[model samples]
Target: MSPTGERVAMATDELQATLPPAVTVYERSVYSDGDSTFALVNDADGKRRLYVAGPAIADFDGGTVQGDGQVFPLTYGNAMALAEVFPWLEPTTAGRQSAFGFGDRIGLATPGHVRAVRDSDLVPVFAQQSIREMDRTGRSPEDVLATAIFGVFQEGYEGGFVADADHLMAREDVERTAGVGFTMFTCDPSEHVVADADSMSEEKVEAAFAQIEDSEAILDRYAGETFEAKTDGFTWSDSFSEIELKRAAVKYYEAIEFAEELYGWVAQAVDGDFDFEVSVDETETPTTHLEHALIASELDRRGVEVTSLAPRFVGSLEKGIDYIGDLNEFEADLKGHVAIAETYGPYRLSLHSGSDKFSIYPFFEEYASDYQHVKTAGTSYLEAIRVVAENDPDLYREIHAFALERFDEDKATYHVNTDLSNVPDIDDLTDDEFPKILDQDDGRQLLHITYGSVLSATDENGEFRFKDDLLGTLREYEDDHYAFLEEHLGHHVDLLTGEIED
Candidate 1:
């Protein structure tokens, strides 16, 4: 053993001898909670647990604790704050690469996510959820982190993971997510991206540019500025002309300003390394080459250190579906984006609506060296519904019917195209046949957007309709759910890693 290991082992031996039989000294350290020198240890149940050894369990109140397991005052809600007990859990400056945010919107898929991530050489973001999703499902950020950590604990996954506060907009949101110990922040500027920017007239563009407070400074820095490839990782075109420069600045200045404000807030409020990203993918128009340059340059000028950026591309990246645009056109746009990354950011090109776009995986595999990240949330939800359909077809039928009704209401906040006429009449299908809904396009989109309604919907009595049945059914078949994700998301990771044969 190393010197530190030897020292820790000796201390653990000494402490384990004094501890009771119900609890064991699983870890050894000199860390103290309040009045007592305590260490995180395992219970007799084989759980990686830490409890107050002596009388301190009842009195301690630092970080939040799960009140059900009242053996000791756990700091990290259920366990002691891992960041305090373990050095690896603490946030640190990222290396050249960062993990893709595996957003577990349903809160039960992390065990499966960890399973997929363990086999690959990729960093896994285990705790990733957005503010809107939290509101829709009535989940707090603390609950999201707790569920993820519990899954990690269940699998005994010691490999480090990142907790991402995805698509954060306001200072209050940052404060709440940081309080729950999120290590990464993706600030979205979708609200600021003006509509139809790619088709804006030159007169309108010039007028918008002329009105910015720092218009002269931003213009002078890039209007006639030139750049060529400096190194290998990120490449620039032969040149960036004045026209391109003006176009980018005109299209993205307002969004840049909003991003800067939010990014600055997160950078200041966060206790450690503020892993920051800029997301502009929710707009109406596709982001162009010059627009990417403009956004990066503006952020850099404001001293915002961006770790990643998501630009809206030409295609429609819908939830729970494959890529919809022309593949060749997408390839051309992707080439320019990679070049922009080479010139502007050695940062990850974040993909926002990246759930089931299978056609694009090969391209990602080919450009794996470009330092990219793809985020997924809805596909996992669909996977959970798949579990319900397989295990309890009655509940599946009820939820599907409810989802069809809730589609219009819930889809207001999302961007997807689904014609109800295209959806099959669920009444015509037998219980055994209900599972086929998942294989169809309209059914996938309908169920995808209406997840919030189906999960949170209630009958006239105000009690949960399908929520209880869904969670219970999932609990009964939890192993099956994990297996499905292993085969499903594992395929996605494999495809991106070039592990899957063409």
Candidate 2:
């Protein structure tokens, strides 16, 4: 029941005076919900807790009451309860806007992400994590989503955000994130995408196509058919021959079928509306024009409402670095992909591994400005590590050296091409120069893919080797961390929104 009163809230300074001596209240976080005033506070121990003050203290359950109200630990349950009081605390959909997924591996980066996104027109998916990331960081889907909610609360950001269950490959993955209230589900069907179809002979392609369910129906529908689409500034037209149709079918039939299945599972898992994104960008081969059109067509035909689709563009979109390929070719390829999205479903064209690709931002904005979603994961973490290198050189040295040792083993899951020999020896550098390694491509990627090892590393006693120190440093110097992310990620938003200076 909503409290009936003139909604009362204590001033930040007043609230801080009433709380414990060491407890500091977040100024922005102080707000009135019903008759009770709620704020997120950090104690001297660096633990964040929820502080509620008002006569309706009993209505706000949990925690010990000090002067006027209770101080509750920022647990998942508390966050959920707070979200009930304020609907804005929950994640929402980005809809048809150009969204950006800022994947926070450590969960402390969303406030910085929020600061960057708030100044731009793009929608923000603040809570995004893959099953692989969850496994590596030992974070539950609940952990990821809750941390994002907490961060959003601490920053007092009322702007809507999307919670993405990113790169989900199985029904369980979708169910898990959906159960935790994710608003978007990205279906990754790369494993099912047959890359060999691109190089197969006509006979081999035909044989492979015969194995597809409803192969005759697919052939009758798309074979020898002319497809055309009009994009923002370009027209795309393509006619598929029987051989080409078979090749496309053999390549993406399974992936499309899997996407359809995943879509159904997502719909069933969620109680209400949820956005769905199909991602085939992680495969070995780039998605061709025909393949993209065919995949979109098939998913649409299967009644899957794809909100966005990440087609593998014609370039090397490697992790934690700039785009690697010819600009002209990429632009030309992107035009067709954008056209396919417009023609089939008008869904956003998502770019996975999208961060730090400063060179391609202009092209994306030019062609798919109104229908694009740029996702960035490791770059934010890299920015945090930069904070460490600048503040605690010894810790940065330890992490960099540990990353070098774990690079080969951890690199198995990623598609990076960083040569360790190219990385500068950190020992030779002065303490002040430690942050420069984050600037070089090889050095950036060397630390990017090995985040799991670095974060999860434990000592002989099973205590965290670097996680505590890393987190503590970031929290203690959050202003600096937020500034770095704001400037760095803000540049990305600026470029994508055409806010860049000449």
**C-alpha lDDT score of every prediction, in listed order:** 0.72, 0.87
In angstroms, what RMSD does candidate 1 have relative to the true structure? 5.5
**lDDT for model 1:** 0.72
Tens digit of lDDT per residue, candidate 2, span 1-502? Answer: 1222222244888888887788888887887855688888887688777888775455455678665778887677777877877788788998778899899999789889988988778988999999999999989999899889988877777778999999999899999999988999999988898988889988899889888878999978987887888866788888888888888888888989899999999999999888999999987788888888888888878899999999989879999999999999998999899888988998999999998999989988888889999999999999999999999988998898899899999999988778988888987899999888999999999999999999999999999999999999998898899999999999888889899842
Q: Return the TM-score for each candidate structure.
A: 0.84, 0.96
Candidate 1 lDDT over 1-502, as tens digits, reads 2111112334556666665666555342323433444454545544434444434445445422322122342335544343344344433334337465677777779878988878776677888899988887878888788777656644545567777888888899998998878878888877777765557787777777677788788767765565543333445554456555655666677788888899878877787776788898988788876677767777887888887888998889888888999999987777677677656767777788888777987876665445677888888888899999888988898888788778788888878887779888988988777768887878888888988888787889998898878877876787798998877788778877778844
lDDT for model 2, please.
Answer: 0.87
Q: Determine which window of 10 residues in candidate 2 has minimal summed lDDT.
A: 1-10
